[model samples]
Target: MAIEHEQLERSSLTRYVSPKGDFIGFRDEDHYKEKLKEWGLSSGKGAKKEFLFKERNYQRVVTIKGYETYGKSDEFNTLVIEFQDGNLCCIHPAFLKEMQASSFGKESMLQVEEKDFSIEEQASETQEQVEKPEPKLEAKPEPKKPKATKPKKEKEPKIELPADKVHFTASVKQFALTYNPFNEENDEVVVLENVVIVEEPPIELGLAWCSHSKTLKKFELQPGDKLEFDGKVAKKKLAKGKDVEEEFIVDAAVQYKVNNPSKIVKNG
Candidate 1:
């Protein structure tokens, strides 16, 4: 017995709009990267199809090369993908690669119709009579001015930060937790506990230490308690023999928050 593969059509008979369309394929590598970016997947050069398909928002529809039929398993191939914003779809690796190798698909070959110029001529004649051309006037001409080009400002090189010096305060801004983490809990307890605004008062190294102690007492940070810090501070390394970089520390803390364990209550 011999095995035979189905022959794909040479031209596509179907049209597709983003999101609503039943088919999606990226001809341009950049477009494929954009789709991956939309899915929150990595768009790096090393990123691959298998990794992008893992995203939930990637979507695509497979068809028999140029055939109009879609979503029918018998007529078209399965295009595994995810759709987001109901606007764009991400094609699977197999489909994307195959489609890119294939021709521009059905987007080629625009339709053109023959037009009869007799109708246009009738309308033009019925409009009005042509007026005589106006006499040309010679006037004084002004000299051309020289064009000026503005110089572009060069971008500042990013500072090379040390390994340990990459402190949390170096972040552009403090991270925020907007979602209510304890909305579904049985009792209406505060999900976020003990928020402290450190790096305030006298700008001294001891200030952070004092605040750390206060935070430990107020929030009761256990072994695995989570804490967030936000602010900016310069990091300096000790130029010594052994504990040079490791011994260096900075002073900066804008805000901090923690999650508290549920409170226990006795039955009435």
Candidate 2:
């Protein structure tokens, strides 16, 4: 039988029988339909009946490709294989040659009707079971608060040292910048209360010692200036051959290394 190539449904990688070989290539179900339509009946020229050359999966009534079987064998059946380069293949069992020969007229296709054309079913193809899901929960937030503060302390006033508690005050009656006996440095020799009354007689308080005449000169006290000072009193300790060395009374604040600024208590 002669069939036009245009009449063939050219599905890629699907199984069919070609004139080149028996049980040979893969083409989709459409190709199978085309083959069946052509091989089932001859039309037009050379109207001789076409023989049943191959079977898909060696079954009759192969009206459609076995999708279940295809899934199991990675979309291919042993009967045929299709290649990317448009090559077709047949997987005829050499061991089953006698069996195939014995079943000669048993699986022949005179018409497109399904006879022994059942696509083989898988032995363990059971349907799958489905499952249900669970629900979810959310979280909540907390409140805000204020912070506490500390208290402060109070201050006290400072009391300076009283002059009476530290020294004696006297008026400068007369003064001279004289050599200091103790240190051999010049100091202010001043007369305090030029005349003092004791036992109703006038007594010369004579001379008293003061420190740092340069400081006193810078300050300038003429006849009377009330000065406050601390001093070592002249004592009566006899020397080896004399009653005592010549002594004076005032030992000024400067002698004690006091650095307080000089304040003129009065102007004479």
Candidate 3:
């Protein structure tokens, strides 16, 4: 039969088929209907015919792609498997040869339905002799009791931070900066306090000049007019010819509002 690509239920793996009398593919009956619709069949088309054919013969096969059969051998029935990639095939033994080229055909010995048990009927006298006994349950004794005790005092407030505890603090401190040879552009540099070390090279060159000084010296930093200069600690030294090391302490040059000052206690 001609199978149209559009009519084909294209799966990343393989397709499936089963006899009409038996449920196939999925556990839900409605799932079959959904799959049929997905395959462009408003309802099952050739399936009914195929199903009837199998029911009459008492031997029908289910086929699946991308899966394998599981269970016993020496029987005609087999479970179709579709695992990864979703290939599934379930077919009767007769169609195995036809599906060989399709990559989803197989025949195996695994046909057998499990047996079920049946209850036998008994006469009225026999039923009476088989008495219904009363339920038997052992009584449980109560557990011994002791007087309630008071709880101990709460643990002492921890003076040390726990290993897992993260402590945070917001703090503010004053830093000082002073300029030497403030009037000579070539001789002037600012020193910062608490800032471990000031590199010889200034952050910026010719930032701004001191207007009041006769030399109108330029600075690496013109922090602002509000920055107070503490001239007492300002010092200058010569390392190489005409190269000077300027140093000073700045207090409160930078400030921040800290939420936890205790964090700084460790620095002490």
Top of the candidates by TM-score: 2
Model 2: lDDT equals: 0.34
lDDT of 2 by residue, 48-160 (tens): 22222333333221112111112211222233433333444443322112123446545443322343233222222322233345655656555556557566666643322
From the highest TM-score down, the ranking of the candidates is: 2, 1, 3
For residues 32-58, write the lDDT of model 1, one tens digit per residue: 553343233433464345421121222
Candidate 3, residues 78-115, lDDT tens digits: the string is 43433233334455433342322233323322221111
Comparison by TM-score, 2 against 3, better one: 2
Predicted structure 2: clash tally: 7
Candidate 1, residue 189: Cα displacement in angstroms equals 31
lDDT of 3: 0.28
Which regions in candidate 3 have their CA more than 4 angstroms from the true location? 1-9, 12-74, 101-268
Q: Per-candidate TM vs. native?
A: 0.15, 0.21, 0.14
Order by lDDT, highest first: 2, 1, 3
Candidate with the larger TM-score of 1 and 3 = 1
